[model samples]
Target: MVSVHRAGALLNEASCFLCRRRTHHHLRFPTPGFALPREASPSRRSSLAAPFGRICTRAQAMGTESYTFGPYKIHPGEVFYSTDLSYAMVNLRPLLPGHVLVCPKREVKRFVDLTVDETSDLWVTARNVGAQLERYHRASSLTFAIQDGPQAGQTVPHVHIHILPRKPGDFEKNDKIYDAIDEKEQELKETLDLDKDRKDRSSEEMACEADEYRVLFS
Candidate 1:
């Protein structure tokens, strides 16, 4: 048998749990066959919806619902692939035809700043993005590089792995790609500054690019 008590009130002739005194306003026990209507309580509906809400929130955090990188809150159309730990997107500037970047969800400056799991996921994601880029660009090779810090030529403060698909004669010299990195980054900055009309890719363009890459990754 269960007993419940309210302030100065006894239930079912039971003593008040707090005051230890029998009082009026006793509650009668329900008969065995009696039950509340299924739809009568809002709490039941809320309980049922809670898991679905949690699932949506989890999906949003994991990049299924949203994609964000550095200061940019990326549109869904810009994200080609994503995992719980990291996501891959098309590069704003391309050293090669199919260059892309893979980065952890949290912003960090250097490789050493990443946790063990993030470090592992970063490389794994980079590798996967490399393979996909290769197939998408029909390239025989790929260049994977990380500008670890400012001294190493990292333009963005956030840690990112650049995956550049390469083909023969793509660069006059193999080491020229390194020089191209600084040149391309500078050019992008200049374009953004000098060209007021220049803007990010439209939703339709990003969606199309994402779809093309998604097929390659698939």
Candidate 2:
């Protein structure tokens, strides 16, 4: 178990993730886990939840922020994913109208840090979303790309597996598809009001953004 002091040091020096800036503080020291103290035993405790309260409080005090990747907006929320996990979200920025993201509920910086169960659950969730995409959009295939760090193009420290639905005409000419998509996303960001205050823009507006991208690619 890591000590509180050590945890603090680790969190502070963390990188900005996407831009390599120092501004993003993605790591936090987990609360020390130990057997319950004698005084917190059920015999004296008023509630079973009390013993776990300190750990929860410490984690919350660590502070966190939300991020958007494509159409999915991730934060602390219940029912965020169709999976039973408490956090995660469906993709709003779909490559083929049904792409999704399968991510962990915790703030793990690297894919190697994921517990065996966490990794398994992530794949299961991706498969589930893939099924949905196939049923809804008639996708020919799905691509699950999991990049671990900077060299692999991981923008956020938190590990996320992008489940992209593949279609027949999604790509035809080149392999630099991601660069093209990122450029179009930026163009939409500039022209549309996707700020926190104006989060949800109409589908018509999104379609217009798509038209702008189609022109660029064409």
Candidate 3:
């Protein structure tokens, strides 16, 4: 049932539920199964449509990926860096080539939740990949960054650091494209979960690791 009162309450805040900021918006809920005591006026319908359109537009901008990071069973491909205990990949973003994401197989939501060894491996993997980027991709520098939550602009809750290879002229050095895309990359990470597990680690070690074990099995 569509309650006018409830709708009014939601509108009173005038904030987007997804982004959570005060903004004038409206959405037309399909009314087939909903009870409506009063018909929506033309102005009301128009107002709702605009915001709904914006929401859909923003959603369509973020494309979904087929797979997640960590140990997973798939066709064997190029292995970037591995410790027999962890692994990483060159992120698809490729700001200057050799961009990689270091993540655990376990589905840990926050950096603080990672077990000690997993935490160590995360940074170590990133560091190793960063060096390889310098040696192989000839990048002048590498940047490591993590977004822990939505407020921090972390779209995906999964903890991962972006290793971007920087070059002298990659950007005008005045543009903030990297930062903007980095935020989107985090969202992309949140949408996928790694499917494989690291077997070399003993059950005891795996237990202590914060990698996503259940998602791999399920």
**Residue-by-residue lDDT tens digits, candidate 1, 77-113:** 5677887889887655454445677889888877898
Residue 157, candidate 3: alpha-carbon lDDT:
57
Q: Which stretches of candidate 2 lie over 4 Å from their true place?
A: 1-80, 84-88, 178-218
> Any idea how many clashes model 2 has?
2
- Cα displacement (angstroms), candidate 3, residue 82, comes to 2.5
Model 3, range 30-116, lDDT digits (tens) per residue? 231111113333443322221211221111111232234433321112233445445564333233334456777576778889999
Q: Mind giving the per-residue lDDT tens digits that candidate 2 earns over 1-218? A: 99999887555423112211110111111111111222222442222111111111112211244544434444322112433441334333333343445677666778788888888887887776666555444567777776677676655556777665555444543244565444433433443343443223223223222222222212
TM-score of 2: 0.48
The TM-score measured for candidate 1 stands at 0.64
Work out candidate 2's RMSD over C-alphas: 21.8
Best by lDDT: 1
Measured against the true structure, the TM-scores of the candidates, in listed sequence, are 0.64, 0.48, 0.49
Evaluate all candidate structures by whole-model CA lDDT and list the values in order.
0.56, 0.43, 0.44
C-alpha RMSD by candidate, in order: 24.0, 21.8, 19.9
Candidate 3 deviant stretches above 4 angstroms = 1-79, 174-178, 186-218
Q: What TM-score number comes out for model 3?
A: 0.49
